[model samples]
Target: MTGYERYLPILLLVGSNIFMTFAWYGHLKYRSAPILTVIVVSWGIAFFEYILMVPANRIGATVYSAPQLKGMQEVITLLVFAGFSTWYLDQPLKWNHWAGFALIIVAAWLIFLE
Candidate 1:
Protein backbone atom coordinates (compact mmCIF):
# COMPACT_ATOMS: atom_id res chain seq x y z
CA MET A 1 0.00 0.00 0.00
CA THR A 2 1.03 3.58 -0.57
CA GLY A 3 1.75 5.78 2.45
CA TYR A 4 -1.61 7.46 2.22
CA GLU A 5 -3.47 4.18 2.06
CA ARG A 6 -1.42 2.84 4.96
CA TYR A 7 -2.35 5.81 7.10
CA LEU A 8 -5.96 6.05 6.02
CA PRO A 9 -7.09 4.05 8.99
CA ILE A 10 -5.41 6.39 11.42
CA LEU A 11 -7.05 9.38 9.76
CA LEU A 12 -10.46 7.75 9.78
CA LEU A 13 -9.94 6.66 13.37
CA VAL A 14 -9.23 10.25 14.40
CA GLY A 15 -12.47 11.39 12.79
CA SER A 16 -14.37 8.50 14.34
CA ASN A 17 -12.99 9.22 17.78
CA ILE A 18 -13.94 12.87 17.55
CA PHE A 19 -17.54 11.93 16.89
CA MET A 20 -17.50 9.12 19.44
CA THR A 21 -16.12 11.39 22.13
CA PHE A 22 -18.84 13.95 21.57
CA ALA A 23 -21.56 11.35 21.35
CA TRP A 24 -20.48 9.75 24.60
CA TYR A 25 -19.64 12.89 26.57
CA GLY A 26 -20.93 16.04 24.93
CA HIS A 27 -24.20 15.89 26.87
CA LEU A 28 -22.40 16.84 30.05
CA LYS A 29 -22.55 20.47 28.99
CA TYR A 30 -26.30 20.25 28.71
CA ARG A 31 -27.02 18.30 31.83
CA SER A 32 -30.38 20.01 32.14
CA ALA A 33 -31.52 18.49 28.88
CA PRO A 34 -33.94 15.59 29.19
CA ILE A 35 -32.37 12.15 29.36
CA LEU A 36 -34.35 10.91 26.38
CA THR A 37 -33.29 13.91 24.31
CA VAL A 38 -29.62 13.36 25.10
CA ILE A 39 -29.89 9.69 24.34
CA VAL A 40 -31.47 10.33 20.95
CA VAL A 41 -28.97 13.06 20.14
CA SER A 42 -26.06 10.91 21.21
CA TRP A 43 -27.31 8.16 18.93
CA GLY A 44 -27.43 10.60 16.05
CA ILE A 45 -23.81 11.59 16.65
CA ALA A 46 -22.76 7.97 16.98
CA PHE A 47 -24.11 7.28 13.52
CA PHE A 48 -21.30 9.37 12.07
CA GLU A 49 -18.83 7.65 14.33
CA TYR A 50 -19.83 4.30 12.85
CA ILE A 51 -19.72 5.71 9.36
CA LEU A 52 -16.01 6.44 9.75
CA MET A 53 -15.17 3.56 12.07
CA VAL A 54 -16.46 0.78 9.85
CA PRO A 55 -14.50 1.84 6.81
CA ALA A 56 -11.39 2.38 8.88
CA ASN A 57 -11.62 -1.18 10.08
CA ARG A 58 -12.32 -2.57 6.66
CA ILE A 59 -9.42 -0.75 5.04
CA GLY A 60 -7.09 -1.21 7.96
CA ALA A 61 -7.68 -4.95 8.02
CA THR A 62 -5.85 -5.18 4.71
CA VAL A 63 -2.65 -3.96 6.39
CA TYR A 64 -3.13 -4.51 10.11
CA SER A 65 -4.31 -7.42 12.18
CA ALA A 66 -7.57 -7.11 14.09
CA PRO A 67 -5.73 -6.78 17.39
CA GLN A 68 -3.49 -4.04 16.00
CA LEU A 69 -6.49 -2.18 14.69
CA LYS A 70 -8.20 -2.42 18.07
CA GLY A 71 -5.08 -1.27 19.87
CA MET A 72 -4.73 1.69 17.55
CA GLN A 73 -8.36 2.59 18.06
CA GLU A 74 -8.07 2.41 21.84
CA VAL A 75 -5.02 4.67 21.85
CA ILE A 76 -6.72 7.11 19.54
CA THR A 77 -9.81 7.11 21.73
CA LEU A 78 -7.83 7.92 24.85
CA LEU A 79 -5.94 10.74 23.16
CA VAL A 80 -9.16 12.19 21.77
CA PHE A 81 -10.99 11.77 25.06
CA ALA A 82 -8.22 13.48 26.99
CA GLY A 83 -8.37 16.53 24.75
CA PHE A 84 -12.16 16.65 24.87
CA SER A 85 -12.27 16.26 28.62
CA THR A 86 -9.71 18.96 29.17
CA TRP A 87 -10.83 21.54 26.64
CA TYR A 88 -14.55 20.88 26.22
CA LEU A 89 -15.39 19.63 29.69
CA ASP A 90 -12.93 21.87 31.47
CA GLN A 91 -11.63 18.89 33.39
CA PRO A 92 -7.91 18.50 33.90
CA LEU A 93 -6.37 15.10 33.90
CA LYS A 94 -4.63 14.03 37.05
CA TRP A 95 -1.12 12.58 37.24
CA ASN A 96 -2.41 9.03 37.49
CA HIS A 97 -4.52 9.51 34.40
CA TRP A 98 -1.44 10.51 32.44
CA ALA A 99 0.47 7.57 33.83
CA GLY A 100 -2.32 5.19 32.93
CA PHE A 101 -2.45 6.63 29.43
CA ALA A 102 1.30 6.21 29.10
CA LEU A 103 0.96 2.58 30.10
CA ILE A 104 -1.70 2.06 27.48
CA ILE A 105 0.65 3.54 24.90
CA VAL A 106 3.28 1.05 25.97
CA ALA A 107 0.73 -1.72 25.53
CA ALA A 108 -0.03 -0.40 22.08
CA TRP A 109 3.65 -0.46 21.27
CA LEU A 110 3.81 -4.05 22.35
CA ILE A 111 0.99 -4.88 19.98
CA PHE A 112 3.16 -3.70 17.11
CA LEU A 113 6.03 -5.93 18.09
CA GLU A 114 6.43 -9.11 16.12
Candidate 2:
Protein backbone atom coordinates (compact mmCIF):
# COMPACT_ATOMS: atom_id res chain seq x y z
CA MET A 1 0.00 0.00 0.00
CA THR A 2 0.96 3.62 -0.43
CA GLY A 3 1.63 6.10 2.36
CA TYR A 4 -1.94 7.40 2.47
CA GLU A 5 -3.39 3.89 2.46
CA ARG A 6 -1.15 2.85 5.33
CA TYR A 7 -2.18 5.88 7.38
CA LEU A 8 -5.88 5.31 6.87
CA PRO A 9 -6.01 2.61 9.50
CA ILE A 10 -4.22 4.77 12.04
CA LEU A 11 -6.68 7.57 11.45
CA LEU A 12 -9.59 5.20 11.83
CA LEU A 13 -8.13 3.90 15.05
CA VAL A 14 -7.90 7.41 16.42
CA GLY A 15 -11.51 8.11 15.55
CA SER A 16 -12.67 4.89 17.17
CA ASN A 17 -10.78 5.60 20.35
CA ILE A 18 -12.26 9.10 20.57
CA PHE A 19 -15.75 7.70 20.20
CA MET A 20 -15.08 5.03 22.79
CA THR A 21 -13.69 7.50 25.30
CA PHE A 22 -16.69 9.77 24.96
CA ALA A 23 -19.07 6.87 25.21
CA TRP A 24 -17.43 5.71 28.42
CA TYR A 25 -16.63 9.01 30.12
CA GLY A 26 -19.31 11.22 28.67
CA HIS A 27 -21.91 9.22 30.55
CA LEU A 28 -20.51 10.66 33.77
CA LYS A 29 -22.17 13.93 32.89
CA TYR A 30 -25.59 12.35 32.64
CA ARG A 31 -27.19 11.97 36.00
CA SER A 32 -30.44 10.67 34.59
CA ALA A 33 -28.92 7.52 33.13
CA PRO A 34 -28.67 4.57 35.45
CA ILE A 35 -25.32 2.86 35.89
CA LEU A 36 -26.52 -0.21 34.06
CA THR A 37 -27.82 1.89 31.21
CA VAL A 38 -24.58 3.75 30.88
CA ILE A 39 -22.62 0.54 30.81
CA VAL A 40 -24.88 -0.84 28.14
CA VAL A 41 -24.47 2.28 26.06
CA SER A 42 -20.73 2.13 26.38
CA TRP A 43 -20.73 -1.52 25.42
CA GLY A 44 -22.63 -0.61 22.30
CA ILE A 45 -20.14 2.07 21.42
CA ALA A 46 -17.23 -0.23 22.18
CA PHE A 47 -18.44 -2.68 19.56
CA PHE A 48 -17.65 -0.13 16.90
CA GLU A 49 -14.39 0.57 18.68
CA TYR A 50 -13.24 -2.99 18.13
CA ILE A 51 -14.36 -2.89 14.54
CA LEU A 52 -12.01 -0.04 13.77
CA MET A 53 -9.27 -0.93 16.24
CA VAL A 54 -8.81 -4.50 15.03
CA PRO A 55 -8.38 -3.42 11.44
CA ALA A 56 -5.90 -0.78 12.50
CA ASN A 57 -3.75 -3.34 14.21
CA ARG A 58 -3.84 -5.67 11.25
CA ILE A 59 -2.94 -2.94 8.80
CA GLY A 60 -0.34 -1.45 11.08
CA ALA A 61 1.25 -4.84 11.61
CA THR A 62 2.02 -5.00 7.91
CA VAL A 63 4.11 -1.81 8.15
CA TYR A 64 5.16 -1.48 11.82
CA SER A 65 6.59 -3.70 14.48
CA ALA A 66 4.44 -4.66 17.46
CA PRO A 67 6.18 -2.25 19.82
CA GLN A 68 5.95 0.55 17.34
CA LEU A 69 2.22 0.06 16.95
CA LYS A 70 1.74 0.01 20.72
CA GLY A 71 3.92 3.06 21.21
CA MET A 72 2.02 5.08 18.64
CA GLN A 73 -1.32 3.97 20.02
CA GLU A 74 -0.36 4.82 23.57
CA VAL A 75 0.87 8.26 22.61
CA ILE A 76 -2.25 9.09 20.65
CA THR A 77 -4.50 7.70 23.36
CA LEU A 78 -2.85 9.84 26.01
CA LEU A 79 -3.04 12.98 23.94
CA VAL A 80 -6.67 12.37 23.06
CA PHE A 81 -7.69 11.63 26.63
CA ALA A 82 -5.79 14.62 27.94
CA GLY A 83 -7.74 16.93 25.70
CA PHE A 84 -10.98 15.12 26.37
CA SER A 85 -10.55 15.27 30.12
CA THR A 86 -9.58 18.91 30.13
CA TRP A 87 -12.13 20.29 27.69
CA TYR A 88 -15.09 18.00 28.20
CA LEU A 89 -14.68 17.06 31.83
CA ASP A 90 -13.88 20.61 32.83
CA GLN A 91 -10.77 19.34 34.52
CA PRO A 92 -7.44 21.12 34.62
CA LEU A 93 -4.41 19.72 32.82
CA LYS A 94 -2.03 19.73 35.75
CA TRP A 95 1.77 19.68 35.76
CA ASN A 96 1.69 16.02 36.70
CA HIS A 97 -0.38 15.21 33.66
CA TRP A 98 2.04 16.98 31.39
CA ALA A 99 4.94 15.22 33.04
CA GLY A 100 3.30 11.85 32.65
CA PHE A 101 2.54 12.61 29.00
CA ALA A 102 6.13 13.62 28.47
CA LEU A 103 7.25 10.31 29.86
CA ILE A 104 5.06 8.50 27.41
CA ILE A 105 6.66 10.50 24.62
CA VAL A 106 10.06 9.38 25.87
CA ALA A 107 8.86 5.80 25.93
CA ALA A 108 7.73 6.06 22.32
CA TRP A 109 11.01 7.59 21.31
CA LEU A 110 12.90 4.79 22.99
CA ILE A 111 10.73 2.21 21.30
CA PHE A 112 11.75 3.58 17.90
CA LEU A 113 15.35 4.29 18.78
CA GLU A 114 18.07 3.20 16.36
Candidate 3:
Protein backbone atom coordinates (compact mmCIF):
# COMPACT_ATOMS: atom_id res chain seq x y z
CA MET A 1 0.00 0.00 0.00
CA THR A 2 1.09 3.58 -0.52
CA GLY A 3 2.20 5.71 2.39
CA TYR A 4 -1.09 7.62 2.28
CA GLU A 5 -3.01 4.36 2.30
CA ARG A 6 -1.06 3.23 5.30
CA TYR A 7 -1.95 6.44 7.09
CA LEU A 8 -5.58 6.34 6.08
CA PRO A 9 -6.43 4.56 9.30
CA ILE A 10 -4.84 7.33 11.28
CA LEU A 11 -7.00 9.86 9.49
CA LEU A 12 -10.15 7.88 10.11
CA LEU A 13 -9.09 7.39 13.68
CA VAL A 14 -9.02 11.16 14.10
CA GLY A 15 -12.38 11.55 12.44
CA SER A 16 -13.92 8.86 14.62
CA ASN A 17 -12.45 10.43 17.71
CA ILE A 18 -13.82 13.82 16.77
CA PHE A 19 -17.26 12.31 16.34
CA MET A 20 -16.93 10.46 19.61
CA THR A 21 -15.97 13.60 21.48
CA PHE A 22 -18.98 15.32 20.02
CA ALA A 23 -21.31 12.48 20.82
CA TRP A 24 -20.22 12.38 24.43
CA TYR A 25 -19.28 15.93 25.35
CA GLY A 26 -21.49 17.79 22.98
CA HIS A 27 -24.34 16.86 25.28
CA LEU A 28 -23.08 19.41 27.74
CA LYS A 29 -24.09 22.03 25.23
CA TYR A 30 -27.19 20.17 24.20
CA ARG A 31 -28.88 18.88 27.32
CA SER A 32 -32.23 18.24 25.73
CA ALA A 33 -31.28 14.64 25.10
CA PRO A 34 -31.92 12.37 28.03
CA ILE A 35 -29.06 10.41 29.61
CA LEU A 36 -30.25 7.24 27.92
CA THR A 37 -30.39 9.03 24.61
CA VAL A 38 -26.89 10.37 25.17
CA ILE A 39 -25.55 6.91 25.83
CA VAL A 40 -27.29 5.48 22.81
CA VAL A 41 -26.14 8.33 20.64
CA SER A 42 -22.57 7.90 21.75
CA TRP A 43 -22.79 4.21 21.10
CA GLY A 44 -24.18 4.91 17.67
CA ILE A 45 -21.32 7.24 16.85
CA ALA A 46 -18.84 4.76 18.30
CA PHE A 47 -19.97 2.15 15.81
CA PHE A 48 -18.30 4.18 13.10
CA GLU A 49 -15.26 4.37 15.33
CA TYR A 50 -14.72 0.63 15.02
CA ILE A 51 -15.26 0.85 11.32
CA LEU A 52 -12.28 3.19 11.02
CA MET A 53 -10.23 1.70 13.81
CA VAL A 54 -10.40 -1.83 12.40
CA PRO A 55 -9.31 -0.74 8.96
CA ALA A 56 -6.65 1.47 10.46
CA ASN A 57 -5.17 -1.39 12.39
CA ARG A 58 -5.38 -3.69 9.40
CA ILE A 59 -3.77 -1.34 6.93
CA GLY A 60 -1.27 -0.13 9.47
CA ALA A 61 -0.40 -3.74 10.20
CA THR A 62 1.47 -3.97 6.92
CA VAL A 63 3.54 -0.87 7.57
CA TYR A 64 3.67 -0.83 11.36
CA SER A 65 4.04 -3.55 13.92
CA ALA A 66 1.14 -4.15 16.33
CA PRO A 67 2.82 -2.18 19.08
CA GLN A 68 3.29 0.76 16.77
CA LEU A 69 -0.34 0.74 15.71
CA LYS A 70 -1.57 0.66 19.27
CA GLY A 71 0.84 3.32 20.34
CA MET A 72 -0.13 5.53 17.43
CA GLN A 73 -3.78 5.07 18.25
CA GLU A 74 -3.27 6.13 21.85
CA VAL A 75 -1.35 9.23 20.86
CA ILE A 76 -3.84 10.14 18.16
CA THR A 77 -6.69 9.73 20.63
CA LEU A 78 -5.16 12.12 23.10
CA LEU A 79 -4.38 14.73 20.46
CA VAL A 80 -7.84 14.50 18.98
CA PHE A 81 -9.39 14.71 22.42
CA ALA A 82 -7.40 17.82 23.17
CA GLY A 83 -8.52 19.60 20.02
CA PHE A 84 -12.07 18.46 20.36
CA SER A 85 -12.22 19.58 23.95
CA THR A 86 -10.82 23.00 23.26
CA TRP A 87 -12.52 23.83 19.98
CA TYR A 88 -15.77 21.91 19.89
CA LEU A 89 -16.48 22.04 23.60
CA ASP A 90 -15.39 25.65 23.80
CA GLN A 91 -13.34 24.78 26.82
CA PRO A 92 -10.50 27.09 27.62
CA LEU A 93 -7.21 25.24 27.53
CA LYS A 94 -5.51 25.79 30.84
CA TRP A 95 -1.89 25.42 31.82
CA ASN A 96 -2.56 21.91 33.07
CA HIS A 97 -4.01 21.04 29.72
CA TRP A 98 -0.88 22.24 27.94
CA ALA A 99 1.36 20.40 30.34
CA GLY A 100 -0.60 17.23 30.01
CA PHE A 101 -0.71 17.42 26.25
CA ALA A 102 2.97 18.30 26.13
CA LEU A 103 3.76 15.15 28.03
CA ILE A 104 1.57 13.17 25.67
CA ILE A 105 3.34 14.71 22.71
CA VAL A 106 6.69 13.79 24.22
CA ALA A 107 5.47 10.27 24.67
CA ALA A 108 4.35 10.19 21.06
CA TRP A 109 7.78 11.32 19.92
CA LEU A 110 9.42 8.65 22.04
CA ILE A 111 7.15 6.01 20.56
CA PHE A 112 8.26 7.06 17.11
CA LEU A 113 11.83 6.24 18.07
CA GLU A 114 13.16 2.84 17.12
Best by lDDT: 1
TM-score of each: 0.97, 0.88, 0.83
| Model 3: per-residue Cα lDDT at residue 23 | 66
Please write out the lDDT profile of model 3 over residues 39-94, one tens digit for every residue. 88888887887777788788778788777777777787777777877787778788
What's model 2's lDDT at 57? 87
List clash counts for every candidate, in order.
0, 0, 0
TM-score (C-alpha) between model 3 and the true structure: 0.83
Candidate with best TM-score = 1
User: Which runs in model 3 stand beyond 4 Å of their true positions?
Assistant: none
**Candidate 1: residue 78 Cα off by (Å):** 0.8
Against the reference, the lDDT scores of all candidates come to 0.96, 0.85, 0.77
lDDT string for model 1 (1-114, tens) is: 877657999999999999999999999999999999999999999999999999999999999999999999999999999999999999989999999999999999899999
The reply for model 1, stretches above 4 Å from the true place, is none
For model 2, give the 10-residue run with minimal summed lDDT.
1-10
Clash-forming residue pairs, model 2? none
In Å, residue 8's CA in model 1 sits off its true spot by 0.7
